[model samples]
Target: MPDRVLVAYGTKNGSTAQIAEAVAEVLRKDGLDAEALPAGSVTAVEPYDAVVVGGGLYAGRWHKDARRFVRRHRRSLAGRPLWFFSSGPLDASASERDIPPVPGVRRAMTELDVIGHATFGGRLEEGAKGRMARMIVRSGRGGDFRDFTAVQAWADRVGQELTAAGRR
Candidate 1:
């Protein structure tokens, strides 16, 4: 199998895009051909060897783009190695960020038979959100809780596993 991977993300404030990029970079470093793309902009996943779909966890749901992407590509995804991630938990604990998947994401995961799923800490800065969003952030521990090291580690592990599986 070829080592091309797609890292697709649905991000409202671009933080998830940044995380996708980081995941791609780490995969590339591990010798996988990987590119990060916006879920809404992607019309097809057929070209990739594997896919990693991600989005922000907002209002107990994934961002619309990610959900829509899964809905559109459900059949194609079911035949391949797929991974899912959810970002955006203002809490300091990355462990605490492991919230359950929203209904849409859970459906996708169930249908696709995903290899794995992860939840990363989110970023919520002042002025980065709307009035209500900002207020919500203000009411919590507002900070950049993204853990890049863990992100890279996860990508590396995934890349290695992908390569190993390809050899089988």
Candidate 2:
């Protein structure tokens, strides 16, 4: 709808990146031009009419890149639609339970007039993560808990919102 949409992500072990790509795909299918780029590559928000930022949650915190992106572009973001999502809750068994929002995310929402914020289950790869991440994954801390249906549903909602806003 906005002629261009940017889906930026900060991923650990690639799960969140995959999720960002999926969201971008769904947005494209909805007749919007969307691209999923790593947060580090995004120097500014000048090219997109809408922005969707996502990152994995670690120890109740979002990735640094994602946090920095929002902080750096807070002003630009305020003039446009912005959505945030965190990939966490790795315990698949806890999929049905209500996951709490990460503190950083909560603060971001309060400080910025974000349109929406969501928490999606994250993944824990066996050997892909760094020492700390792997240790956490191995210590029975998290599991592969992503729900595709829910992720797609959220993406669709974002697409609809962007479309409606474009019309206005």
Candidate 3:
């Protein structure tokens, strides 16, 4: 059970960060104390009663910053409720199974005893992408795929769990 929750995310062009913030907003609306922050900037997990880590997924890989943050704080996050999320795939109809969490996430999810994981639709802006990413976007795989409704619903579910679990 956790009252103070940290919704941390790693993003290259800010899509994942925006989703994280929205998740925090939902959690706050649910009467929980929560904060949205860039994963790379978060140095400690001690202050948080729970943590939600998210990142932009690309080519079956999670963001390096998000991965690093989890690895560095794995011990600190051993308990107290933890979850992971990723934003990728251009189609909302596509199951998360089509674009699964990377190997690193699989390992951390198991080792950390993560409560759950979600994969949401992602957005790709041409100018924001790097060389390789831009190439992919140029090939016509870019648009706003974020489903806010889905995000809110997922947040609400997590918030309910946190609420029921009660403050630690």
Runs with alpha carbons beyond 4 Å of true place in candidate 3:
94-100
lDDT tens digits by residue: candidate 3, 15-101: 999999999999999998999999999989999999999989977888888988998898988976898889977876534344556
Determine the C-alpha RMSD for candidate 1 after optimal superposition of all C-alphas: 1.7
Worst 10 residues of 1 by lDDT: 92-101
- lDDT value, residue 58 of candidate 2: 76
Instruction: Quote the positional error of residue 74 for candidate 3 in Å.
Output: 0.6
TM-score of 3: 0.92
Writing each residue's lDDT as its tens digit, candidate 1 over 84-159 gives 9888888756654456776778877887899888788888887775675788767866678898877888888888
lDDT of 2: 0.84
Lowest lDDT 10-residue stretch of candidate 3: 92-101
User: With candidate 2 superimposed using the best TM-score fit, by how many Å does residue 111's alpha carbon deviate from the native?
Assistant: 2.0
Candidate 1 Cα deviation (angstroms), residue 88: 1.0
Clash number for each model: 0, 1, 0
lDDT score at residue 19, model 3, on the 0-100 scale: 94
Per-prediction TM-score, please? 0.92, 0.91, 0.92
- By TM-score, highest first, what's the ranking? 3, 1, 2
Clash count in backbone of candidate 3 = 0
- Runs in model 2 deviating more than 4 A are 140-142
**Per-residue lDDT for 17 in model 3?**
92
Q: Considering every candidate listed, which one attains the maximal lDDT?
A: 3
For 1-168, candidate 2 gives per-residue lDDT tens digits of 586999999887899999899999999998899999999889888889999999888777898888888888888888778888888776763357656557788888777778887788888867866888778767877567898788888899999998887788
